[model samples]
Each structure stands twice: as C-alpha cells, then as structure tokens.
Target: MNDGPGGPGDQAAYDVVVVGAGVVGTAIARELAHHDLRIAVLDAAADVGDGTSKANTAILHTGFDATPGTLESRLVRRGYDLLEGYAAATGIPVEPLGALLVAWDDEQLAALPKLKAKAEANGYDRTRVIGADEVYRREPRLGPGALGALHVPGESIICPWTTTLAFATEAVRAGVDLRLSTRVGEVVAGDGDRPHEIRTSRGVVRARYVVNAAGLWSDELDRRFGHRGFTVTPRRGELIVFDKLARPL
Candidate 1:
C-alpha cells in the first residue's frame, strides 16, 4: 500500500478507492479484490478497527424482531448469512449464545405472541414462547413474578475486531492498497475517461470510482457531493466485558 510520504506520482493509480477502513469498508474492499482491479482503502485513523468499529459490541443481530418485508430486514438476514459463513471460513470465533427477551409485566407478556409472529413473517420460525417456569429453569436466579420470555436461538456474537482485521488482511493480501491516517477532505467527481480526485490529509489520490463508507462522516462526504438525505449524530453506549468466571453469575 504506498503509505510513504511520497507525492501522488509514487502512489499508484486505483480503479476504486474506498474511504474508510472500518469493517464495512474492509469487507467491501475484500469483495472487490476478487475482481481484476486496482483498489485502495483510506481511513482517518492510524490503524484499522479504530472509530465505531473498535467499540462495537460484536453482537450479530438476527433481525427476529425487525419489521417484516422491509429492505433492512432482508439485508440483515442476507448479511448475517454471509458474515456467518465468512467467519467460519476465516476462523473468526462466533458464539451462538442465543437471547431471551424476558417479560416482567402483563403488557410485555402479551407481546410475545406478536413478536413470534413477526419473526415468522420475517422468515425466522425458531422463536418460541417459554413460560416463567422454563425461564427460571434456564436462568434459576431470577426476580419473583416473571411471566414469560421469547427465546430466539439464532442470536450470536463474534469477535468484531478480529472480523475487521481478517477482512483487511485478506484485502491487503489480495493486492488492495490500504492507506490509513489519510482522511478525505474533498471529493471531485470524474468525467468520462477521467479519474476522480480525492483530496486527503496526506495528499491527493486519483481513482476511477469512489465509495463513501466513512461511517459517521459519510453524511459530510455526501454533502460534498451535493446530496443531503441524512445526517449522523453520535451516541454513547456503555459496555461491560465480563470474565469467564462471571458467566456463571
């Protein structure tokens, strides 16, 4: 990946340039590497897995509760299968620990059937309603007066950092250029038979096609291209990683 402090002449021209080295960008880079094309991945961080990807919880959402027949639901389902298979092939650890949506009140209890129906409509039919006895039988140390739970056995977790690393590694191994710490400042579209110019912190990069996968800054980049359909607002979340000994508790 020509990460040297050399000028644009030292950097090889690319057919496609992906702005972001996060999981999504890396995955896109890897997939494009299969084609016979010059590809480059640029990111603002010093290394991959920085930004929101590093802080991800690694949970593989099953979309069991997602609205049925929607684009998001379909994409989630397809992406889940692709990721699951990729993880298995690449030795990325995935834990299918499953999940239980517990109900402590009557209103929540009455929602289990609807949730299960939604799951069914989304083409996931393994969800089931388990009574409180079964809930306590599975999780014996629960508070009193619990009603029921929706057991979704497809929920799983994976190593988010490893997944991103794996994708970046494969993409690099396949000859995709990776340029970290190169934040894109401006994007100039290309004309017919000409290349697009990406103005970055390091230098200008020329590419035939540009992909905006910059995550949080994607909207800002879109604005540079005269499109403003969405905006990104950062949100904070707290994560607690428990040791193996805490699993029993």
Candidate 2:
C-alpha cells in the first residue's frame, strides 16, 4: 500500500492530512490547493468512493428544511450551489425530476398544506399542493389510495460517481498526495511539540494538521486521537435500481 515513491519507515511529511476520499473530503483537499500546503488525502479502500458514498439514492439535496441556520444547513446549501456549478462545468448528468409527496388518506391529505408551509419556511417556496386530478395526470401509475400530493419542483437526481471522481481527480492533479489502503493504526506524538505522527500499516506518516472525515469509521478515529467526542451508528440503506428502459421519470 505504501510501496509508492516512499517505502516503509520513510515517514514523509505533509502539511495537511484529509482523511477519506468521498466527495466532501476531496473537495476539502481541492480547496486547500489555494494555499501552498502539501496535502494528503487518505482512504481505506483500494479505490475511492467504494464506501457508503457509492450507494444510496442519487439525489442532489437542496438542504431546504435543514434547520435553516446551522452548520449542516450552511454547508449543504453551499455544497448544492457549488456542485450545481461543477456539474455544469463538467459533464455530470442531472435530471430535474420533481418529487410528489403523495397523501394516501384524509389524515395524510391534511398534512400536505403543512408540508408546503414547512417548505416555505425552509426557503423553498416552490412546493405546493396539487389536486387529485392533477396528481393522477402527472403520475398516471400512482396507487389508487392517493388523495393528493405536494409538488417539490427543485428535487433532482444526480450522478454521484462523477461528482466524487471529479473532486478527487482535480485534487490529485493539483498535487495532493492521495494515500490509498494505508490504514492508520496508531498515532505517536513527535518531539513533544511537533505534528502528530500517524502510524499506519505502511509506516509512519506525519501531518501538521488533520481533518477526520472517516464517515462510518469516524468513531474509531476519534478514539485514536484520545477524544471520544462522538460515536456513530452506521445505517446502510438498500435501493433497487430498475433499468433505465423500465421507466423514465
């Protein structure tokens, strides 16, 4: 794994270390390129995007209703705008297929207006309630119990594969050292005041700063740093993708 330019015990130094090569991690690495810093992005997989990043529904989130003013909301909104422009710059595909939140019964139907109001509160004012006739017209194959639906026009599908790859490729081309499969096993302090030394399966690696974006393994990494700030409950979702010819929506 570490058999690249530097062999075992080479103990090379990097200005910054960004863990994980998911879309978010790669973007951080790319953003660091503006500074004259030696950055290294690490991943446990043999290739990038082989984790939860590869799976799940491929929706480009609008982050509407993300509590409006928190870090999550801010980053998601910024990432949405950034990725939108990036998709245009590159050739990544995105289909603006609006979503229809169906209401199957009277109780569910009563929730439509509230959902629309919530969307408005979330700075997404495009959502509105559609009558049954229009709902049936839009989705001809909808189940018989649907009374109405809330139309969210900003929802869209995206190609997450290219999104992650684009950030990784650009970061690598911009001189970010991408260390693959070099799993960090332990951390050793350097000279009682120097950068933290990461002991990996390959050898010792040093970094002045570290950004932990380990996703599911975030807990394990926090323990390695002697600080259990948070723990993770990894949940995996399974989606069955019908063939493109199956239907177009």
Candidate 3:
C-alpha cells in the first residue's frame, strides 16, 4: 500500500483508478487486480473503511425486501452468497442470526404475504409469515400487540471493519496501489488513447478508466464527467448499542 504522496517524476498511468477506499472501492480494486490490470485506490481518509462503511448496521442482507427486477436486488442477492463464502474462507466474523419484519397493525399484517411474495420474486423463498403467537414464541420479550412478522432467516450480521480491511489487504497484496489521504479534485478528459488526468490533493493520477465509489459525494463526482443521472441525498440513522445482557432478546 503506497500511502505516501506521489512525487513529480511519478508519471506512470494506471489501468483503473478507484476513487474511494471504502468497502465498495476496495472490493472493486481487489476484483480488478485478478485481471492483471494496473489498479490504484485513492481515499481522502487516512485509512480504509474510515467513512460510511464503518458506520453502517453491518447486516448481510438476503435481498428479501428489495424490489424485484432491479439491479440492486440482483446484486444484493448475488453479493450475499459471495460474501458469505468469502467470510467463511477469510475468517471474517459473521453471525447468521436472521431478522424479523414485525407488523403491529392490521394493515401491516395484511402486507406480510405480499412481502413474502416479493421475497420469493427476488429469488429468496425462505421467508415465512408467522403469526403473533409464533413471533412471541421466538422472541419472548415482546411488549406490544404484534400481528405477525416476516421471518427472514437468511439475514445475518457481520463485521464490516474486518471485511473492508480484508479486501484492502488482499488488493494491496495483489499489487494494487492504495493512496490514502488523497482527495480527488478535478478530472480532465483524455483524447484517443491518452489516459484521463485526475488531479488530486497530492498530485495528478493518470488512469485509463476511473470508477466513482465516493459514497455521499458520488453525485458531485459524476457531475465532473457531465453525468446527471442520479442524485445522492444523505440520510441520518442512529445506532443504539445494547448491553450484552440483552443478547437473548
């Protein structure tokens, strides 16, 4: 991993340059390294997974609730199996504790079957709709009148930090240049076979192809290349830590 700034004489271009060192960025870099390509990963943070990747809920979703026929649904379903196997082989901590989509009202109760059907459409057929009695039976610490719940048995929790670190470590071992604390500024288009010049805080990085995995700032980066297909709106979520004594619940 080359975490230092590039010198003036460092003019060698890369085949692919990933814009972030988060989980998605590192994963892309690691995958690209298998193709014998010259890859580089750049991040504004001092270390890998220092952004939203470390602050997520760390759930390995089954795509059970994802909208059917979407690219996200397909990728999530495929990624779940891939990540599960990778975690097993790489010693990444994972707990297959599953999840429950609880329904507290009659309207929500009526939607459980639809949700189950949606899960089935997304190629996940393990979801079962259990009544309130079964819900309380599985979770005895219930405190209200729950109608029913969609028991998604494929949902699992994982250690996001270890996962991202593993990808970055593997990519670095595979000769992918990792540049930390390098913030990309402007992107200059290249003509013909010339490499695209990416101006960063430290120096200019030339690459044949550039990938944007900047998370919240992805839209801003896309506009640099004259793309306006989508916009990113940041949403705040709260993470509550419970004592280990409440693990049973």
Q: List the residue pairs that clash in candidate 2.
A: none
lDDT of 3 by residue, 45-103 (tens): 99999999998889999999899999999999999999999999999999999888999
| Candidate 3 runs further than 4 Å off | 1-3, 6-10, 243-245
lDDT of 1 by residue, 92-121 (tens): 999998889999999999999999999999
Model 2 weakest lDDT span, ten residues long: 1-10
For model 1, the stretches where C-alpha displacement exceeds 4 angstroms are 1-3, 8-11, 241-244
The alpha-carbon lDDT assigned to residue 220 of candidate 3 equals 88
Per-residue CA lDDT of model 2 for 105-196, tens digit only, reads 89999988988776666667888799899999999877787789998888888988888888889888898888888777788644546998
- Give each model's whole-structure lDDT: 0.89, 0.81, 0.91
Which 10-residue window in model 1 sums to the lowest lDDT? 3-12
Point out the worst 10-residue segment of candidate 3 by lDDT: 1-10
RMSD of each: 1.7, 2.3, 1.8
